[model samples]
Target: MLFNSSGFLFLYLPFVLAGYALLARVRPRWATGWLALVSLFFYGYWNVRYLPLLMASILFNYWVAGRMLAAVAARRRRWLVFALAANLALLGYYKYANFFIGSVNALTGAHLQAWEVLLPIGISFFTFTQIAFLVDCYRGLAGEYRLVHYTLFVSYFPHLIAGPVLHHKEMMPQFERPPGLNAADMAVGLSIFVVGLAKKVLLADPLSTLAGPVFAVDAHPQLVEAWIGALAYAFQLYFDFSGYSDMAIGLSRLFGVKLPLNFNSPYQAANIAEFWRRWHMTLSRFLRDYLYVPLGGNRHGRYRNLMLTMLLGGLWHGAGWSFVVWGGLHGVYLVMHHGWGALAGQGPPRCWGRMLTFFAVLAAWVVFRAPDLSTAGDILHAMVGGNGVALPHGLEAYASYFPVGCSFEGIRWIDFSGVAMPALLLAMVLAFAAPNTQQIFRHYAPCIEQLLGTPSCLLWSWCPHSYWGLAFSMLFLACVFSMNRVSEFLYFQF
Candidate 1:
């Protein structure tokens, strides 16, 4: 049921879109119901066992929200607290129970058996989405909604699996409007989707191959290997997650809905703070508003709160100490950025800021991609030439940084030596230079709203002309031809 799979691309999507177009004009409710059922089907197709869990979650939250919407202030607080607790308890048990048990077993010599519970797909996303709804309800922000409309919003296929963490206020009204098949919307959505699919199929997937071997559990890659692998993975994730977001937004647009902008050109960010603003932006905003603000964000002990938020945010990504370290590194980066800003009036020069911020991010991503803390340390050590400097090819530009006596003649741990370097460099160029999906379709307001102020003129814009159509059609063909081995999006694991 991967979005890239032919089954989804050809069969499931076509059928769903056709049905919605047929019903939406006169029977918008039916169309909404149709989408809800299809979304559920899409989820269940991955794992039937989790279908009930998802249903139960939706029903409970809907009921709790309804109760909150009707209750007195005191009762509403109780219901909101109860709802938050229930949602978090479910997420914790499924996502963190094993991590907790393992930590306990390691620390105190307790042989606590790990629970065999399988983590449900998109548990973190759906749970957080509902948690936001509950909090808004408590804040008297979330208004009442029919059960059917709520169901569709929660289960909508485009943002269901991986998300921009849709807010009730943002999405509920869209569902209230009659769903229709607009040709203009379809053309724009399809163009955006084709570009996204090309990004994943042509760029992200192949880059994964370049990165995979270097991060093997036993492979202790050297300086050149490490940098190439690290850059490959960094760019890989950039395209993979952003590509998925583009596809999600475009698909939703086909239904005459625009999902919030999730991934802008984060690599273009000149500082860690700017990076957070651009990367997984909804999640960062969630951490800011829901977690940080509630925790007295920048009001009392700003640095302390920032660190705690990042540590928790890192752990939120996965059940690993490496993830914690990843979060912690960013936390430190932010703290330093803030501290420096206080001493000086502003950040470093723009060029210097971009370079420093990139390597800083590159270092953190090493930890994020590692199998464990030990492996992460090993990779970082190699990255700095700790494990003897050697060169398979003449790839080193910073060779003077190495010990003077170290000989670097011939060592080749890297595969596809000739192809790898060029591919990686080209990928970096694309990541740093290419116009993102939003910019490409900016003429049409490709997202829920344009988060970016103006589209960069680095690339051509999407237009209603046949040339645009033909170009997108060619891109579509390229993606389709290249989808020999369909792979799950990297964010799907989260």
Candidate 2:
């Protein structure tokens, strides 16, 4: 069930939270078991058919960890390899089977029938979490925990779908601790949740309308059309994914679990490297420590390692060539960033870096959002003025001086009279200038703080006084009004 849905926000969540809170106070062991069960139920709420698959995955990983821990040196390595292969094989079959079959059919005239393998929600996240767990176990960095704790760590409802990608060491200990509801934490959690819900319903979904028309264009868009669509999508993705991350953090906090920070203000980042550090942070950490480090990292050919990690990372997102191109472009951006740093001996000015980084990301988002290479090329061509510029009919005299393709009343999709451009401008301001959810809630230490480092950009802090309470009350009311059209978080596809 989507966190934004009324069923979850109203009925399921209240019942589960109340039960968990009471159980934690009375029977600690039962609290843990109860949470694990409800978490499983939450996953099942999406698709009951996949419940067994999730359980099987949990059981398999737990057993693999056990076997790996019990073995000798070579045996442990062997078990680790076996477990990794098994986990990957399952993921590949489910996530990539159709793509593989389709590609083969296109290339060699082979009519390979694609199998009907429905990908389980959060498969990528849970698989990666378990893989990291098994690797840490092999390296003696992680300890074996009880089955219930392991189950909860994997199945926890907050980060289960679109995730911050929980680490075992970060989560398991919390489940092992005695459960008691904290009033301060609960308040912080509700406030964060309300803010996130507002973002998703109010900003992200509406912007999707602008982005939708632009992407739906059958051919190259006009210059203005391209920018409108691109900018609209850039912010739509920012709020959609960012909103989900905030809700995840807030929901986990309600259970007294502080999930690692996921969505910082990535757009404010002055460089591509800094962007990665800010966006989808736990996934970046996993890729760095698990994939990049294992592939020789910078100890060998740094550029080559970057390409490989990003390529695989892109593939991990989906089974499509568009994703590969998106990943490949980021790989190039990182190489240029590092290459520039090495030669210049210092970074670019903050303003220059921030603008350049944003444009670079904007270009990459076109590819990421496109259905294929052809569509991406069309959009990029238009973005570079291959299509022409569109101006209002009254500006004909001014348009004649341009010495380029200029047309009046060329737009057929974007509606400026509506909330399109206004909302986009608002989003741009909020993204670049505003403090993020973590910053606004920094005073409460609502999320894991050390990873985000010191709060260097706090415009304001949250206060628990009546003024703030009334403001949040109106914000919450606005959130409820916007919830009339509930939608799924964008990251769920990954």
For candidate 2, give the lDDT: 0.86
Task: Give residue 432's lDDT in candidate 1 (0 to 100).
Answer: 83
Question: lDDT by residue for model 2 over 248-311, one digit each (tens)?
Answer: 8888888888999998899999999999999899999999999999999989989999999999
Which segments of candidate 1 are over 4 A away from where they belong?
393-412, 417-421, 444-465
In order, the Cα lDDT scores of the candidates are 0.84, 0.86
| Top candidate when judged by TM-score against the true structure | 2
* Ten contiguous residues minimizing lDDT sum, candidate 1: 451-460
Q: What residue pairs clash in candidate 1, if any at all?
A: none
Q: What shift in Å separates residue 426 of candidate 2 from its native position after superposition?
A: 1.0
Residue 444 miss distance in model 1 (angstroms): 6.4
